[model samples]
Target: MLGIAAAVLFFIAFLINAADITTNDVFSSVNVMLIGLGLLALHVAGIGHGRRTGRR
Candidate 1:
């Protein structure tokens, strides 16, 4: 569940970045990239938690 949430959040960030790039908003693009990276990290942490618990 947490992994799925993180994936969705990252996807939203991707969309935001794409929109910003299309509009030539460099600052917003960078911000979106940072947000996406944070979400990716969360996703990885969730995966680690599952691994530690021996759950698929």
Candidate 2:
């Protein structure tokens, strides 16, 4: 799930960068890309992987 989120964020950042969008400092393409990287790192660290509950 986090990988998916990172991919989406990366795509958004790519779109923003490719389109040359003008936005606030917080939501800039670089920031989005950084956030995506952070998520990817967390995913790699196995932080958010929930255990599955087997059905009875």
Candidate 3:
């Protein structure tokens, strides 16, 4: 669930940044990168939990 939430957030960030890329805002790009990093962290955490619980 957390991973899924993170994925959604990352997608939203991408969409927002892509829409405003024409303006070339550095802050927006940074925010998107941060969102992507957060998503990665959530995915890693989910994988770790699955491995520890030995469940599908």
Candidate 4:
């Protein structure tokens, strides 16, 4: 799910920032954090959620 993906992104961003890695512009921790925020927002807005079946 997107929520899971967002969590992974947040973790990656945390690692990047904690590790002090700043070599690439695209993979920058801040950018990844922002992306994670976007995903979180989407998750909050009920996007990318799996549809549930009513009964078996």
Candidate 5:
């Protein structure tokens, strides 16, 4: 699922940030984290919309 993938990405990012594994800050930046959370929100919204419309 997208939410699971996003959570994995977030964990990876956290590890990368904590371990100083990446020289590029962009890879472990808050922007990337926010993007993952945005994906989760989008997924939830899609489910809500689907249920409301009764499309399945």
Candidate 6:
């Protein structure tokens, strides 16, 4: 869920920045993408842990 949220945030941010007609802030998009990827990594780690412990 958190990963999904992050991805959504990144997508929205990308759309907003892309649609703007002013100076492009590369940091914003990069930050959002990083955050999304971080969340995804966390989720994957959690899943791996759960599987290793045999927890459903």
- lDDT, each prediction: 0.60, 0.94, 0.65, 0.90, 0.70, 0.67
Please write out the lDDT profile of model 3 over residues 1-56, one tens digit for every residue. Answer: 55766677677677777786553565575676677677678777664344365568
Error of 5 at 31 (Å): 2.6
Cα lDDT tens digits, model 4, 1-56, are 88999999999999998989775899899899899999999988988889965698
Clashing pairs in 6: none
TM-score of each: 0.41, 0.86, 0.46, 0.84, 0.61, 0.54
Alpha-carbon lDDT of model 5: 0.70
- For every candidate in turn, the CA RMSD to the true structure comes to 5.4, 3.1, 5.0, 2.5, 3.7, 4.5
lDDT of 2 by residue, 1-56 (tens): 88999999999999999999998999999999999999999999987777755697
> Distance (Å) between predicted and true CA of 34, model 4?
0.4
Better of 2 and 6 by lDDT: 2
Report the C-alpha lDDT of model 6 over 1-56, residue by residue, as the tens digit: 66577679678668757876343566566666777788778877674243355568
Instruction: Judging by TM-score against the true structure, name the best candidate.
Output: 2
Superposed Cα deviation of residue 52, candidate 3 (Å): 7.4
lDDT of 1 by residue, 9-51 (tens): 5676677666654544544645655665676687676643553
Query: Sort by lDDT, best first: what order?
Result: 2, 4, 5, 6, 3, 1
lDDT of 5 by residue, 1-56 (tens): 66776798788768777876755656665756887898788777674243354465
lDDT score of residue 21 within candidate 6: 33
Clashing pairs in 4: none
> By lDDT, who's the top model here?
2
Off by over 4 Å in 6: 20-27, 47-56
Which residue runs of candidate 5 sit more than 4 Å off their true CA positions? 47-56
